[model samples]
Target: MTSPMEMDKLLHVAQSCAPPEAIQLIVQVTEDPHTHTFAKLAEAPTIQKLALTPEGAPYVQLLRLYTTGTWADYLSMAHQLPSLSAAQVAKLRQLTILSLAYQERSLSYATMCEHIGLAKDLRESVRILEELIIEALYQNLFTGRLDGVAERLDVHSVTPRDVPRTADTHNGHDAVFGLLQALRAWRDRSSDAITALDTYKRQVEQKYDARAQTMQEDHAALTDALRNVAQSDTGMVARMRLQETYPDAMDVEANRRTHSKRRSKRTRA
Candidate 1:
């Protein structure tokens, strides 16, 4: 069996020319003792080109696929087929669907059949989807399954395809401009986040300020009430002084009694 790399080389050569020349080149390839060349070819390309030729017309449309061509191009190529062989037509149809699956990811059987103008009847549409998936699997063009319950194609992988390279390559100025635009977008997002945070901080500060003011008012009122109570009750001040001057309440009371007794004795004497 040819390795994937060898097949890639063969396909690359096959793509370099029109169908006739491409077919010839692939056929002419041979494996040598020292030289590296692919010997075998897939018949799909020849079939695809024959299918692309229309009946009663000199024009031969060669459709590019699985490389630089778009989904639309593949579909157009399939539509161009005119009374080709069954196998040839099947190859082209399956290839077109693989491209479509790669693009859409998931597509309903009915919708796809309608898009590709498959059989008009419902039963025929489902049959077509199942057959196409089987063909794609055999060709290694697509890895997908039919969802009978959902009436859809569940695609896992498809042959790699890429957009055609554009001629207008960007220069240093374009790169710089792109970078500047990205930076501006980031800065704008940062500014918005900062603004939202500032607004939240201000709200929190206002709540904290209001709570602190209320606490201060309560503290002042309680202090004033304690002062008023001290002024009205003379005993409270005396008790406080006694507690400060004497170690015990009994000692302070004993001193007061001694002074009173001494004043009485002097009067008596």
Candidate 2:
């Protein structure tokens, strides 16, 4: 299976070559299972230029049929347009199923039959529809079950068909712009949260530093008070020791002072 990228490159190479070769390549890409998208091919300048010519008109229409039209669409235009091969028809049917699945998960038998333009007879229509669905299952187009009793197709999942060119272009732009906006919003929110965290961290650090400084200052003041009390205690203790050692000398000094005062009073008398 060719990747979409390779298919796109092939498309450009086709358009660059002769007209006959280019149409052939385009048809192959349209029928390619992996080449499910067609907006780019349809919009290619070479294809558009060719489509303006008489010979290239029908082929361009065929590409559009595969791009946005269904099997019923082909049937309606079969008289005027080129017919598709068995594989291409099958793929178209599968693409139709995918489109239906996208619209609703539970598709009624009648609705699907009418959409695919199946047989009018109920029994024949159901049998053919079931066969197409089973074939699509093998192709991995979708995961679904035919609800015979309910007369519906219960779809679990489906590969998406290509978007119409107009819608594809518009939605592509919107999707890109929306993604950019979301990324910007996310960046802003993340930046704000980081800033708030840093601010809170700084506040906590400042508070801690202030508390630590206060503690140091109080410690220094307490140390100075203790040192002063220690010096005073040492001086009083030395004086106490000196008085204990000179007890008799201290008494003799006191008595001599008292006797001198008494003799001076007698002389005066």
Candidate 3:
């Protein structure tokens, strides 16, 4: 596998060279599936510098085409890339399939043939299309199955292509803007969810605290009531015991008080 580091080294070489040499190297990188980082390569200062030159504009445009354009895009460029190698052309067609699968899950054979420039008879085109699908599957470009009966490619998943920063007739700006809006919407939803969870957590904690406080108050009141009841019961039992010990004590005490009062009155007289 061609690594990002290798691609970076190649880019550095391309940048230090003259415009013609840089264009050649960039094209080589674009054609190689493992080193296909045209999105980054296209934005390099060397490539941009090349674009400023009249002779380098075509090559710069070709790099941009590889970055985000499809096979149909190449055909529509008025045969400007007549010198592109057969292998490079085929690679571009394969990348076109990836782009199609990214856009839609199900692809009919006819659609693939038209898009990939398979201008053979129906049977031959279908065969070529199947071969391309198998190649892509082997490369792990996408997860999909070829439905021979349906004559369609049912894509389960696909890797997304890099979106171009520059505006072309394909409306790259709209795509970038739409992606930004989606990210912002996801952020807002996540924030709202977090806020709701925090509120719910606080509410549950508050309820538990209040319930504990109420239980403590009830326990204290019950303890106080029990103590008072016990004290009252003890006092009543002591009084009953005293009565049992001296049943006629109250009558004797009353008589003694009357006698003492009578003697005191006689002395005073």
Candidate 4:
């Protein structure tokens, strides 16, 4: 029999390894009476000398025995251990969510392996974490299945034919795996489209700005030429009016035009 403390330590180590069978075994031994007795014996001071014995029962069977025989008491005893590490707690949190989402008796080894592998990257891990949390909340708040006890809650087992071994990856959450993949792909495509649209918008804006600047320069040149023509025409009208009133003014204006024309020709030459 393992001491309560010893069981706790073993369970902790098992959880670190993230073996699916190990998790189920821990749950079982903690719930069983006969296993619990051995576990307690293992905790005894004299037996403690043999605590590290290699001949001890496999950890999973021990856990299963405890869980089956004394489920409630085993849970109470297990909870007495100091809390798990933050990372371990996080992993358990994910497991709890998956347990509810899949409606399984417990998280299977395949599912556990898939989750751990998928969670290797922080971004993907966080997303998986959130999905698990939401699934847990759904089960608890709406379904009233906090511990995954409902017989009908278990996910339907997939047929062997449905398995996609060609992908070269183990998929843990097969129920939602296809949807997740599609969503990720859509997000990537949408992001690329937005980037392309922004680039096109900048290019169009630059073209319009350059065209506007060219038009402004052309307008300024046309305005200066018009102003010069208007001034010259006004001077000609004034001279004509002065010539009608006095002929001598007309002669002076004529002489200025002849000299102005010569100067204009010389500048052009």
| Number of the top lDDT candidate | 3
lDDT, candidate 4, equals 0.43
Query: Given candidate 2, what's the lDDT at residue 50?
Result: 73
Task: Give the per-residue lDDT digits (tens) of candidate 1, residues 84-170.
Answer: 445434444554575577556687877667655576457876786688677567666667777878878878876643232321223
Would you estimate the TM-scores of all the predictions?
0.39, 0.53, 0.61, 0.27
Better of 3 and 4 by lDDT: 3
Candidate 1: give the clashing pairs: none
Lowest lDDT 10-mer window, candidate 3?
245-254
Which residue pairs clash in candidate 2? none
Residues 134-193 of candidate 2 have per-residue lDDT tens digits of: 867776677888788888889998766555545443444543554467579879999999
**In model 1, where is the ten-residue run with the lowest total lDDT?**
30-39
Candidate 1 off by > 4 Å: 1-60, 63-83, 138-140, 162-269
Candidate 3 TM-score over all chains jointly: 0.61
The most accurate candidate by TM-score is 3
CA shift at 137, candidate 4, in angstroms? 8.1
**lDDT value for model 2:** 0.71
Number of clashes recorded per candidate: 0, 0, 0, 22
User: By how many angstroms RMSD does model 4 differ from the true structure?
Assistant: 19.1
* Per-model CA lDDT versus the true structure: 0.54, 0.71, 0.76, 0.43
